[model samples]
Target: MKRFDEIDEHNYSSDLIDEMFKLITPEAQAKTHYRMGLAAKIDDALKAKGWKNQDLAKALNIKSSSLVSKWLSGTHNFTVDTLVLIQMALGIQLLDVGEEDKPNATSPDNGNTPNAPVELAKNIDAIKQSLTSVANSNQKSFATINYK
Candidate 1:
C-alpha cells in the first residue's frame, strides 16, 4: 500500500542488497583480504617448515605461546618490531619495508592508488627539515631572550 521512493526501491533489489552487504561487511574489504592471505601463507609456511607456535614465541623472545597465536590470527595489529621479527624468523617478506610496493598500494576501502614515491619521500624530508629548523629557531629565540 505504501509507495517506495527510488532510493528505497534501489535498496531492495537483490544486486543492490548484495552490494550493500559487501560494503557493510568486514571481510569484503581489501585490507582484510590482504591480511587474511598473508596469514594463510604464514600458516602454510609454518606447517611446511615444521615450526610450532612455541618455536615462533621463543624466536620472538615472547614468553607465552598465546602471544604467538594472537600474531598468527590475522586479527592482532602487530607492531613494526614484531613484523620485522616475523620476517626474519619466517624468511618471508610479507611487507615491503623499503620503497618497493608503493605505487600499486591502495587505500584500504576504495582501492585508490597511492601517491608517487619520490614525491612522498620529498615531502617527508621537507617536513623533517622544517621541524628541525623550527626547533633550532626556537632554541635560539629562548637563548636570546634569556637575560642571565
Candidate 2:
C-alpha cells in the first residue's frame, strides 16, 4: 500500500477522470455547455454595462450578491422567470424562446435558404456590429460568417 506522502506525482492517472467524462451523455454535455455559455454571455453583458455583482443583484431584486455570483459561476440552473428578469435587467436577450425562425443571409449554415434553420451563431453580436458599421458607412456590406 502506498501512503499519500510516499506516492509520486506520476502515480496518479488522468485516464480515470477522462473515462468519467466520457460517461456523460451528449445531451448532458450540451446542456452544460449551453449553461456555461449563457453564464459567460451574462458576464460579458455585465462588464459592457459597467455593472457590478451588487448592481445585478439589485436589478434582480436579489438580497444577496453571492447568489448572483453563483449564477455567474455557470453551475446554477436558471429558471425561465429568472432568466427573463436577467434579460430585462441587463437589456440583453438571454434566450430566444417562441420566436419564429428567420433564415439569415448572414449565416453560412443556412446557405441563404428561407426554410433552413439558422444554427446557433457564436459570433452573432460581432456580425451585427459589423453590419451596423457597414450600414452606417457608404461602402457596400459584405459579411463573412464562419460557423463551427
Candidate 3:
C-alpha cells in the first residue's frame, strides 16, 4: 500500500494539478488583471512616446530591458516599490481609482448619460491613432510610463 504522502491528495491527475497550479489564486488573479491593464496603458504610452523597451528600461534604471519585459508580461507580481519606480520613471499614473469607484461620482442625469461610453470609445480610438502615428513616424519620443 502507498503511503499518504506518496499518493495524490485529491485523486486529480498530475496534468490537472499542473494546470491548476499555473493559475494564481483569486486575489492574485485580480492583481494580475490590474497589472495587465496597467501594462496595456503603459504600452499605449510607450507607443505615444515612440519609445522602445530599452528606453523604458533605461528610464527605470534597469541595465537590462528584460526586467521591463517581465514587468509588462502581467504574470509577474509587482511590488509597491517597483510600481513607484515605474511611475517615477514614466511620469504616469498606474493605479488611480477612477470615477467608477468614486464615493460622490455619479453617472449624471439619472444615469441617462448614454453617450459617455461612446465618447470614451471615441477618445480611446483617437489615442490609438495618435500612438500609431507616432510609431509609424519613427520618432524617437519619450514619455512617462508606469508598471504599477
Best by TM-score: 2
Off by over 4 Å in 3: 1-25, 97-100, 103-148
| TM-score per candidate, chains pooled | 0.49, 0.59, 0.48
Let me know the TM-score candidate 1 reaches against the reference structure. 0.49
**What does the lDDT read for residue 86 in candidate 2?**
92
Report the C-alpha lDDT of model 2 over 1-148, residue by residue, as the tens digit. 7778887877676788989988987556656766787788799999999999999999888899998899899888999999899999999888766655654222334435322112333356678989889787744433344446
Candidate 2 achieves a global lDDT of 0.75
Where does model 2 exceed 4 Å of error?
1-13, 100-148
Best by lDDT: 2
- Better model by TM-score: candidate 2 vs candidate 3: 2
* Residue 141 shift from truth in candidate 3, angstroms: 72
**Candidate 1 stretches greater than 4 Å from native:** 1-20, 23-28, 99-148
Question: Model 3 shows how many backbone clashes?
Answer: 2
Give the Cα lDDT of each candidate: 0.68, 0.75, 0.67
User: Would you list the clashing residue pairs of candidate 2?
Assistant: none
* Model 1 steric clash total: 0
lDDT of 3 by residue, 128-148 (tens): 999999886664443344436
